[model samples]
Target: MIRIRLGARGLGGVRFAVSPVGAAKDLLRLVGFSPGTLTPQWRTRATDALSRHRLGLLAVVGGGGPLGYAPDFIRPEPPAFLTDINTGLHQIATTPQERIRYELAGAVNGHAWDPGSGHPPPRQLLRALDRGEDHFAHRLADEMARFWHAALAPSWPVIRARLEADVTARASEIARSGLAEALNRLAPNLEWRDGELLVHMRTDSIHQLTLDADAVILTPSVFVDWALFCAGEPPGAPAPRTPLIVYPAAQADCLPPAQDHPLIGAMRRKLLAELSQPRSTTELAQRLYLSPATASYHLQILHRAGLVTRTRRSRHVLYQRLGGAT
Candidate 1:
């Protein structure tokens, strides 16, 4: 269990920010050989993409199979609000060499290997670390750049949209409820109580963190299923002992529909036909004699495909067919 003790000031200091660098790092885990217990469809997509690319760093980064660890330096705490991959990469590139080496050494020395499995860092990486090669840091950064370009950059638009939507929903929740409720809603494993946030982790050990003046930055990540915490620091400085928590983004009820899938296309067409007049998911479900869950699922797909547009009428969200979609 991880417990964070926040004072009155600390609790008030909580804020949310999006982290593209953190999300990209999480993608490495998602697309790795053993991405833990993801939804079947997402897992299949990530695995297929990794197989197609065959990145060399796969072994080094994914050595632990599904539970592998990437070196922490790749996603050092963002010095500022991260807007894009370039900003994130620039923060990483500008990190002092000593800090990079220190983190690498910690990753090497602190890594726990499974029985019969080699260490997480590849031999070539280890050699560079041991020899203190100045070029190793640059090479590692380059590898991350390549990985981003090849695997993540193309899909960033859809990914960013989903992330932004989640953030918007979360902000709404906070406005309607409170910070504690918002935190708990992010994941089932989290509980916010009197002056303390409790995190139920898979580990047996217990840990505690106290936030004094520095606010706890809550970052939303799509790839991580469980909550993770890392220390934050000002840009260009070493990380402090205390870290902010990164929790999994709340899952939308419906997965985004694949653009070219025949079934999805057919569903969108059906939804479009029914949506000539604006209809809520509940109304459409009742009219079609389908479960609300199923109706909402297909409706969201249609909405995302540009075949439908949604409008808010007081509390109800209504959808209608868009122009040019028969």
Candidate 2:
């Protein structure tokens, strides 16, 4: 269990940010062995891509081994909402070597893998860290950039829209209710009371964090499942300057089980299949060989049934499937 004691000013200091790098890191976690925790639909989508690019990404981020720790450098906290992949790559490239080394050492030491029992860190990676080679960091960053472009870039638009929607919904919750109410709703294991935020972690140990004057950055993540993760300075270190709390985004409810129900027609089934990612009406019309008006009509029906959601992006309005619709 982790308990965070917030000062009187903590409530006013809360802020929110969206990080592309963080999302990419979460994707790494999703592709790991524990992906079974993910929705079956999303797991299938991610695994299909992983099979195609397994060899290329394997060298950098090893297989789903017991000592599975992607270098901590890849998970840098963004100072602001990351607008593009290039900006996030730049952040990874420019991270101070000292910080990178510190985080890497911590990951290695804190890992619970039995020595020589499971896949170990890549030989090249171990050598690079031992010899303090800067090239290794650059190579890791390059590989991450390549993986992002090939595997995740295609789905980024939909992912970003979902993240943005979550932020807007959270802000509305804060306005309608209050900060405490919003915080409690973030996850089942979180509670705000007595000027402290309590998080029930899987572990039995109790850890307390004090946020005296620093604001906690609440980041909504699509790939984070189960428990909330707190990122801040290591225990007993210097007072934390910037702290982040990441919680899972609310997923759409599971698709209704009556697939062959009379209410669901052929067009609605096609729309649901294509909605794995968000699409504008024009895009849907072009792909489905239907007129824009027809596509819009079906979309409205799907929206009413709570099977999909719509959001306006600039001049275009996009719709995406909710939950794990088959």
Candidate 2 per-residue C-alpha lDDT over 55-90 given as tens digits, one digit per residue, 9 for 90 to 100: 343334432235444544566666776546777777
Cα RMSDs, all models: 7.1, 6.4
What overall lDDT, based on C-alpha atoms, would model 2 receive against the true structure?
A: 0.65
**Whole-model lDDT per candidate:** 0.62, 0.65
TM-score for each predicted model, relative to the true structure: 0.68, 0.70
Model 1 segments more than 4 A misplaced:
36-54, 62-68, 79-82, 111-121, 130-134, 206-213, 232-237, 252-326
- What are the clashing pairs of model 2? none
**Model 2, residue 152: displacement in angstroms?**
1.7
Question: Which candidate has the highest TM-score of all?
Answer: 2
Clashing pairs in 1: 34-66, 230-243, 231-243
